[model samples]
Target: MGVIYLVRHGQAPMHAYSTDPVPADAPGLTDLGVEQARRTGLELARQVPAFTAAVSGGLARQVATCAGVLAAFGEVHDGPLPEHVVDPGWDEYLIPALPGGPTPDMYRSPAAYQQVLDAALLRWTAGAADSDETYAEYQERTSAAVDRAVELAGSGQTVLAVSSAGTITALIARLWGVPAQAWPTLARAMVNASYTKLLVGRRGITVVSMNEHAHLSAADVGLATFR
Candidate 1:
């Protein structure tokens, strides 16, 4: 049997939804985000010392988180690490700049920003986003990426993939047979640097866990983060 781990990337500025200066699409991990990734790596090294493959979405935050996890894992385990693969297919769905949407003042309030983001996501999933990729296309891209990872893990090996909350939760929601409209609930619940586990064998891929973040809290209670 083989296993696959889906890790959500650590937090980025995501200034698109706020007044921060960073560009949402190009920002990297925050300092706390780096720590979260390191802790997640240590936990993975303890749980599974050997990995068959390590992958990340091509985004800056995802790539950084993957490197951090592998670096931490390498510190404790005296084994050769797998070369990291960059897969754009696993990238998060685009968050378009909403026109005539929330004002800059609205971005100042976390509650207001969340409300707008959630509503915008709902519309995006319904094929209303201004972006070129539809929800169906996004799903197809992520699903294909997952298939590639599972194939890489083939038989008694484990694969680790670092991705964004939106991409990870979308895949999980589909596997759980949940409607796409409810995807935001799962995405919102995902913690930064959290991992979801899947078992692959004769019975096919089965979700063993979702959003496992005890490692973060174990390291530091304040490290538990959803944004």
Candidate 2:
């Protein structure tokens, strides 16, 4: 059996919504985010010192987080570490633009924006909203990305993949036979820099653990964040 570690990238600055069409570059991890990734690496090194493969979503945050983990791991372990590769398939699903865009007031309140986002996601996953990348298409892409990790971790090896909360939740929900409608419940709870372990064996993929964040809390409770 092989183990697949799905690590959610650390916190990134939330994108502010506006009527202006100027495209913003995808945000990278914050200072706290960087530290969280380092702490996660410290714990991973102690538990599993080596990985057969390390993959990351093409997003800047995911790439940075993957590097942070590997760098911190190298600090403690003198052994070889897997080369990191970019896999756009593991990227977070593109959130559809809200109708008329969000108002200035909505942007001011994180809670308000979250409420709007939650509704939009619910509609998207339920097939009630139109998007360039349908929810089903997202599932296919993420599954393929995970299969790549499984392939790399063949036999007794272990693989690590850095991704976003939504991507990780989507895979876990599917593996656990949870319906798409309930994805928000799991997605909302994903802590930054946390990892979920999946076992790939003869029977098939099975979720061994979900959202392990003890490493963050052990270092500092404040490091555990969800966004």
- lDDT of model 2 at residue 204? 82
- Highest lDDT: which candidate? 1
The sequence of per-residue lDDT tens digits that candidate 1 reaches over residues 1-227 is 99999999987655523434654555478889999999999989999979889999987889999999999999999989999999999998655443223555664576776687788778877777566687778888999999998898799999999999989989888888988889988888899999999998887789999999998877545798877
lDDT of each: 0.84, 0.82
Alpha-carbon RMSD of each model: 3.0, 2.8
Error of 2 at 56 (Å): 0.6
Q: Candidate 2's C-alpha lDDT?
A: 0.82
For residue 8, what is the lDDT in candidate 1? 94
Clashes per model (N, Cα, C within 3 A): 0, 0
Regions more than 4 Å wrong, model 2:
15-27, 96-108, 219-221
Worst 10 residues of 2 by lDDT: 14-23
The TM-score values for the models, in the order shown, are 0.89, 0.89
Worst 10 residues of 1 by lDDT: 95-104
Candidate 1: C-alpha lDDT = 0.84
